[model samples]
Target chain A: MEERISLSHGSGGKQTNNLINDLFIKYFNNEIISEMNDSAQISLDGSKRIAVTTDSFVVNPIFFNGGDIGKLAVCGTVNDLAMSGAKPLYLTSAFIIEEGFEIEKLEMIVKSMADAAEEAKIQIVAGDTKVVEKGGVDGVFINTSGIGTIYENTNIKAYNAMAGDVVIVNGTLGDHGMTIMCQRSGIDIEGELKSDCAPLNSLVDSMLEVCSDIHVLRDATRGGVAAVLNEIAEMSKVSIELDESSIPISEEVKGSCELLGLDPLYIANEGKLCCFVSEAYANQVLEAMKKHSLGANAAIIGRVIEQVPQKVYLKTIIGGKRIVDMPSGQQLPRIC
Target chain B: MEERISLSHGSGGKQTNNLINDLFIKYFNNEIISEMNDSAQISLDGSKRIAVTTDSFVVNPIFFNGGDIGKLAVCGTVNDLAMSGAKPLYLTSAFIIEEGFEIEKLEMIVKSMADAAEEAKIQIVAGDTKVVEKGGVDGVFINTSGIGTIYENTNIKAYNAMAGDVVIVNGTLGDHGMTIMCQRSGIDIEGELKSDCAPLNSLVDSMLEVCSDIHVLRDATRGGVAAVLNEIAEMSKVSIELDESSIPISEEVKGSCELLGLDPLYIANEGKLCCFVSEAYANQVLEAMKKHSLGANAAIIGRVIEQVPQKVYLKTIIGGKRIVDMPSGQQLPRIC
Candidate 1:
């Protein structure tokens, strides 16, 4: 482990994994916490199951193309709960704002958060606000924690993926990462390149309505699709072979990533999700996902295979295959 | 409202109230959210009542004399839920670390958090870590959100206080604020002045066992006893008369406050709490509190008076009466 924390420690990549396992897990060792999943599943009175998740959004330029920090904070937490197949019920937001920030901007950000909450059918039940002196912090940081109720029959988890399952993503990738990068760098592309930041609870509900036998459901947030698939492969002890030609990528985001010499698979996507479902329900789930606006670009990208256990492979359009390794270092910091 | 946010906006005083009311409440106006109390009261399945709370700890110098930021974070959120008469069940922690912070220090902090959770009989179920660039933030800031189950037949809220209720505070006041101030300012006193940051759930449970009719329970944290009493007075539409000589204050804290020309009432505390109960149950609750180690100095400092509505009065030792107003501006920032 590094002696001092670096930007990579928060990258949701290999270094972040090391920090969690080497330090966080070492000290916070417990049954539920050690699962190391996106959310913690807890049972109430040995009858009801609930999922809880937390995330802190320190995205630079609090305001971005699709949404602001507040909107991103709510969606991030809600999506985490949805990934666990829980219906997000309540959210708590804690904001740490630097002194001298514009009150109008704060109001706008909060309004955006309220709007997002309404769309997701979740309530911002509790909140705390702290203001620090100028230069003590950046513009603002929002931490949101959500609670959701998981139904009785849903058996969704990262470790639940099986060898014969099919993989599907709800929408396009790299839109959020590239948009934030473009906004921060003050660069403009020929067409509008907005973030794909949205809540996925509705889409998850639509899919579960058609088929609740999904093995794995994960939102490709910090590390994009590659990271999520790689983690699923490792956790479920299965191999994933992705068809590159079937992966959905917007033209604007693709052009932005190509111009910057970045791989779209490694970029972040806020309002997207990838699911592993039984082969019998893959087409039905994909069709259901495509019915929703947020999942209009739904596509089947890959399938779980038994050849390379605990690994992910990308079968390129050029008839070549390469390992889709977990992201290594900080590709882009503060890209919530 | 001011054009830009100032340090006073987060002071947990009058300015903080203004910011919350004029902005946060204006847009997030809802029945439950408009209450604007420490924690929000929420119901699940229309049968089970729960309390959810969130707090962000930006206490400077992350390490302090009695407790570090990690301990403060857990105790802060736990106390919030305890104030709502809830048995805290789970907590989620999100840490935002500066780029160059030492890994050893973070480990120590996480260890502190775990120890505090164990003591409070809660689990640190889920967590998120985000590392910002160097100079982007102070050493570390932790945001903890807690979920607690509110037992039946316990009606406790800020507005539940009545005119004839008695006010009781467990332990001494202002220890946390003074200790942090002394540590940050490099001033050492002759005797020890440690922070009173502690979990008050056990004490609360003891009191509840003795008397479930406790009207209001609140921890005197940021703006201390004065801020809490004033808010209760306004919320319940009642007046309070406090005997200055009856309030508990340690000798060292009194001396420090005298030397610094600061009112002990306006200072912060972590382990202390104040409750409002009918005069009938005050003695029983006080006896129960005194039985616990955390409430050895529990005392009846005041009672709800009918002289003035929506006001608070302090009767001095010299037999003079004066108004105890809400704190106006930021006396101490980042004191947890």
Candidate 2:
């Protein structure tokens, strides 16, 4: 059995090939990868078009409750392209591995990335590997670049959220961040806390089928809902008013946040998306999102309006109005 | 002065903006990067182009010539695309920094990446950072991913080498490897050998103007000349014969190799290239190479053939044919 990765694994020889086949290919079996060429050649149908997006995942621990860094890396990039109303296609992965990291762990991460790609209906077309001396590198940092086919002439961007567009979320917030924090800090919650890492491209596809004119689609990560709102408001040059009662939040995540002195809105989410759609099409998008396992807790939480401030404001249940600012610092560093 | 990177540098807040503006923007000061946008959108002209070839640099100590990680990362990827005859456009960098490393050292590395991007006329469009706990990581490791635009009509691949093709190296070999080895092993071979890390896209532009039909361009990197020859023979299914006497080697590198029990051929090069061209235009290509500063020692070392064995054979000074094979395993790790 392979105990760990020796320096020879990155030497571009038989060891590299063997490792890729035994671990990576076994889990990430796909048509493009089967060739094992330098770079995967993706044949695109001109009529269909293409979209490209790249994202890097440096989540703290390689493995966590519901997923691992590999799964998060694949899902993250796929979702970025999917948000542009694109049908995800090919993906390229780059890995920075610290010396002395267990080869088994890397294999696990690779497997997870492959599995995520399969679930998202995308191919891991190309990849690169770099090894850093021990102490100079982190365990593993992953970057993924994806190219996808856009479905027709769909136009979706951060600035697409118009005045009167309704804001909707696919699921509860803070589950991914809280799960990791609890695990890393040895904090026990009243209930089991699991990260929500998952691929949301299919759910995006489904929603786009119904609400083809959806104003915006964004994954709630890093700075979470608050940051997403800030970006959208700035891009659209419009203000957004959010209803605290309408935003979905599970009691478990809320409790965990309170215990840790963290704001759920500022925390990260892996399996969720925050979408803004025209009021007329909001219900259809919500229904489509609800059909997917990733977006079952979907809810409409806010509306956009023409305003000079182009800011986001939250309306508490007690009739208090306050600005919802983007998180000042990373709420969860190393979050995918 | 702050000696190390604090949490502020990555906070995406004031410090992050400052770092971008002060150091990165100052050196890398390009219009695209200056905008500080998430991605760069570039306009390209339609032309017949295939990314074309080489790089060879010696990292001293066999590493640490200048950039143990960051600059090396940038030059490595940029040079690869240059070898492919592609116009490099975007890059992704990954870092492995050892724990307890002076924050200043890490910042310097990052700055080196920024500077290399500027000099190579590429963009640091994407990046990743990871920190391995002390002893778990090394001083630093960098992996760079570069994307270049391929000119639509230029078709170039290793398998395209023809039997009547003439081979030429951009410059002399073993200088980079020898320089690094001498420095690392405490050999004072005419002062610590300085690496030849450099970008070759400019040199390629000059050569392509004259000989765009050059069959194959390969960078002589790890495993050096022997490895590249093996690849060409297998890819084109053609026999290759090299005259040992025609190949160029520096006296310093030869001396260092002899003293250290190493083969100059097996050592890594960071800033040189190997080119295969049609014999009819070989002399023209040689003249073009001679005009460039980096190709002072350019030499026609070998040629392709239709021999049945389809192997790379080197004719020794005594007229004996010996086999040249790919490296069996890691000759030197972390050379990048």
Candidate 3:
């Protein structure tokens, strides 16, 4: 590890994993965190199970094309719990605001959080506010911690991927990362490019109705689909093969990535998730997902394989095979 | 409200209350948050109740006299949960680090956090880390959210104070605020002065054993005992009378405050808590508190009165009385 913290340490890629494992886990070692799931599953009174997750949103632009920091804060944590097959019930929000920030803007962000919590059917029950002197922080940063109840007979985990499982993505990728990148760099695109930052608990509930035993469920946010796929592959010790033609990508995001010399596979998405389930239940889960408004573009883009264990391979439309490696450093900082 | 947020908005005094009520509670309006206890008490499965709380630490000079930001972050949230008469079970930590911050320093912070969590007997089950560009933030900030199971048959709240109840403080006051203020201003006090930052869950447990129905248990942080007493007075619709001579203030803290022309009442103490209990159990509670190391200097400082409802009065050593009004603005910022 480097002597000084770098932007890549928070990239949600290889460096982020190194920091979390080498520093955080080394000291705060415990069985629950050792599992390395999106949320930590704990049993209360040794019977009732609950999922807990926390995230701090430092998106550079407090407000963006489609959503603000507040909405992203709630949805990010809510989605983490949902990925663990939990029904998010309560959320606690804490804000660290820079001095001289506009009060009205703060109100707007709080209102957005309230509205997002309403959409997710969770309540923001406890909160704290801290104000620092000018320049102590960026405009403002919000941290949200969510509590959720795990569903019965449901065990969704990253290491649950099996050899005969199929990989499904709910929507197109790179919309969120590309939109923020363009907005920050003053890039004016001709097509629609807005963030896909919405709570996915309802969509997750719909898919679980079809099959409660989904093998792996993960949201591709900071490091994109490629990162999540590589993680699942390593954790489950199973190789994965992706079909490039089947992977969903929006036209605007594709154009933006091409123009900016970036890969859609490495770009971030907020309202997207990758699901792995047995091949027998793949179509049923996809059909259930497509019926929801947020999952209209759901597609089965990959499948688990036994060859070359713990690796992800991309099958190109040109009939070529390439390795999809975990990102080494950050491409976009504070994208989510 | 001011057009822009001032340091006072986070002072945990009058302005902080206004910001919370006018903005946060107005938008994030719910029955749980409206209770406005240190931690929100909610029932899980409509039977087993739990307490949840969140706090962000932005104290200047991360390393202070007796504790660092890491220890402060854990103790702050743990104390909040304990104040609600709950057994803290888990905590989630989120860090927002600035680019180029020292990794070694971060490790020390993490180690301190681990030690504090171990002392509180709580597991840090989930965490998130985010890094921003250099100058985007001061070195780093931490937000900790705690979850604790509410003890059965216990209902501690701010509005539970009765007219005959007595106010007791666990230990000396203003050590935390004065320590930070002196360190920032380069003041050298002759006597010992350091933050009393420690997890009080065990101490609270001891008191609960003596009387489960203890009323208005609160840690005197940010705005100190004066602010907390005023809040309880307003909430319970009763007057509180404090004997100036009985209030315990360390010799160092008293000298520092006098030298700096600051009032000890408005200063913060991280490890101190104010307890309100009926006169019947006050002696028993005090005896139990004194048995604990953290409460060796415990003293009964005041009592609730029907006169001057919704106010706090201080009785001087010379038999004079004065109003301990809720501070309007911040005397010290980022003292937590």
Candidate 4:
């Protein structure tokens, strides 16, 4: 391991996983936490189960095209819990503000957070605010932790994917990562290149309403769909075969990624989700997802296959197959 | 509100309250959250209540005499939940680490957190890590959100203080704040000047075992004992009369504060907690607290008085009386 932390350690990629497994998991070893699930499920009163997840938003330029850091913070954590088949009910936000920040800007960011919470139908129940000296931090960073109730029939896990399951995605990939990249690098795009940072709790709820037996429901965030697919393959000990043509990729995002020589598969998406559902329920879930505003681009782009266990294979446009490994290095720092 | 946030806005004093009430409470207004208690109590499953709290630690130097940011983050959130008469069960930690930080230091900090959580009998169930570019942040900042089950027999609130209630502190004040101040300023002190940052759950549990009717419990962290008293007074609509002579202040902290022209009353103590109990159960609770290692310096410092509403008065050592208002204008920034 590197003696000093590098950008990749926070990239939500292979390096990040190694760091978490070697340090955090090794130190804070416990049954519930050690599982390393999207959210930890805890049983209360001997019966009811709740999901809890946390994420910190350090996106550069706090305010962006479609959503700001505040909205991203709320959506990120809420989506994590929702992906775990839980109905996000409460969220707690902690803000670390750099001293001398504009109070008006702070108010705007908070108002954005409130609006996001309202959209998700979740309450911001508790909060903490800390201000650091000038130059101590780059503007403000927000950390949100969410709590959601797990329904009775819901049993979603990364390892729940089966060989007969179908892989589905809720929307186009890489809009968030490309938008942040363009904003940071001062790239001028002809079209409207904005982030896809929307709350996906409603989308997930709608999908689950159609089929409760969804094997694996995971959000494609930090490391993007490639990383999520690799993780699901490894966790379920099944191979994932993705059809390149079937995957949804917005033209603007694809053009930007091509210009930047970046792979859209490994680029982060905020509002998108990757679902591994039973073959019988995949069409129904996709239909339900397409009915939602955020999931209009829903597509069943892949399927679980047992050809090679613990690997993701991308079927190319040229009819060749290649392994899709987890993202290794930091492609975009402070993107989320 | 000021145009730009000054250090005082995060001082956990009058200014901080105004920011929360005017911005956060105004935007994210909901009944439970709008109350702005230390922890928000949410009823789940129709009858079971759970307390949730979030706190972000931005203490300078990352590592201090008695504890580091990791330990402080865990202890702070756990203490908040405990103060709400809840048995803290789960916690989520989110780290915003500056890129190029030493991995060894990160490990040590995480180990410290694990130790603190173990001592408090709480599990850190989920976590998120984000790395910002160097100079984007000052080392590392931690935000912890805690979930605790409210005990059935307990009902503690800041506004629950009765006119005849007695206020008690678990130990001496100002050590944590003074220690950080000295460490940051490189002050050479004679005696050991370390933070009193420790888990107070066992101490609170002990006190509750003896008297479950404890009216209020709160940890004196950011703006210290005076700030806690002022909030309690305002919330409970009662005046508190403090016997200055009975308040415990360590000799080293006292000397340092005197040299710096600082007030011990306004200095934070991480491990120490202030409790308001029914007059009849004050002695029992104090005795129970005294038996605990963290509360060895337990003392009854003040009592609720009906003379003046929403105010705190101190009976000085020289037989003079003075108003102890909330410490304002950032007496100590990043002292948490």
lDDT of each: 0.91, 0.66, 0.94, 0.91
Top model number, DockQ: 3
lDDT of 4 by residue, B217-279 (tens): 999998999999899898888999999999999999999998898999999889989999988
Q: Which regions of candidate 1 are displaced past 4 Å?
A: none
lDDT minimum window of 10 residues, candidate 2 chain A? A37-46
Candidate 1, residues A52-107, lDDT tens digits: the string is 99999999979989999989999999999999999999898888999999999999
Candidate with more favorable, higher DockQ: 1 or 3: 3
Real contacts retained, model 3: 0.84
DockQ of each: 0.83, 0.07, 0.90, 0.88
Per DockQ, what order, best first? 3, 4, 1, 2
Report clash pairs, candidate 3.
Answer: none
The native-contact fraction of candidate 2 is: 0.08
Model 3: residue B267 alpha-carbon error in angstroms: 0.3
- Residue B296 alpha-carbon offset, candidate 3, angstroms: 0.3
* Residues forming the 10-long window of minimal summed lDDT in candidate 2 chain B: B49-58
- Candidate 4 lDDT over A1-336, as tens digits, reads 899998999998999999999999999999888777899998777788999998999999899999999999999998999889999999998888989999999999999999999999999999998888899999999999999998779889998999799999988999999999998899887788889998888898888889889889888888899999888888888999999999999888888888889999999999999998888888899899899999898999999987954689999989999989899987689999
Docking class of 3: high
Structural RMSD, model 1: 1.1
lDDT of 2 by residue, B213-232 (tens): 87777767656777777767
